[model samples]
Target: MVQAYILIQTDMGRAGDVSAACAEIDGVVSAEDVTGGYDVIVKVEANTVDELGKLVLAKIQKVQGIVRTQTCTVVHV
Candidate 1:
């Protein structure tokens, strides 16, 4: 599986709602409200890299309160 950590930014006071929505997405393993530049941090997995991109673009990004996201793909060396 392809795994990544998605750092999400949300509209002010919407972190809880955004994280909750992301947590329910099929590929999302976990989503939590967080502090710092990003509001929510999500762990997600998909069958392939393409699917990962799709999950981010077609699913997670579509969450109502999400403003922006940065995907950090996991790599094994």
Candidate 2:
């Protein structure tokens, strides 16, 4: 399985809205509003890298209030 953490940046004052929307997406395990350069952070998992990509690009990015995102895939040593 592939796992990733997506760091999301949203428009000012929209972090809660973004987190709420992202939480309902299929691949998103959890989304939380936090204080940092990014507004929301989401954890996601899928059976393949391609599927993970689709989850990030097609699903997560489509949520309203999101401005930008950086995806970090987990690597096992």
Candidate 3:
């Protein structure tokens, strides 16, 4: 399985809404509003890296109030 952390930057005052919306998407494991560089931190998992990319690009990025995103794939050594 492929897991990733999506750091989302939302439009001002929309962190909670964005987080909630993200949490509803199919591949999303969790979504929470946070402080610092990003407004929302979303944890998602997919069967493959390609699927993970699609989840972020097609679903998460399409959510309203999202301004930008940074995706970090999980790696265990």
Candidate 1 regions exceeding 4 Å error are: none
lDDT of 3 by residue, 1-77 (tens): 98999999999999999999999999999999999999999999999999999999999999999999999999961
Report the C-alpha lDDT of model 1 over 1-77, residue by residue, as the tens digit: 88999999999999999999998899899999999999999999999999999999999999998889999999961
> Model 2: residues >4 Å from true position, as ranges?
none
State model 2's lDDT: 0.93
Q: Which residue pairs collide in model 2, if any? A: none
Residue 3 of candidate 3: its Cα lDDT? 91
Clashing pairs in 1: none
The residue pairs found clashing in candidate 3 are: none
Against the correct fold, how does model 2 do in TM-score?
Answer: 0.96
**Residue 37, model 2, lDDT:** 87
- Two-way lDDT contest, 1 vs 2, winner: 1
Residue 73 alpha-carbon offset, candidate 1, angstroms? 0.1
Error of 3 at 18 (Å): 0.2
Best by lDDT: 3
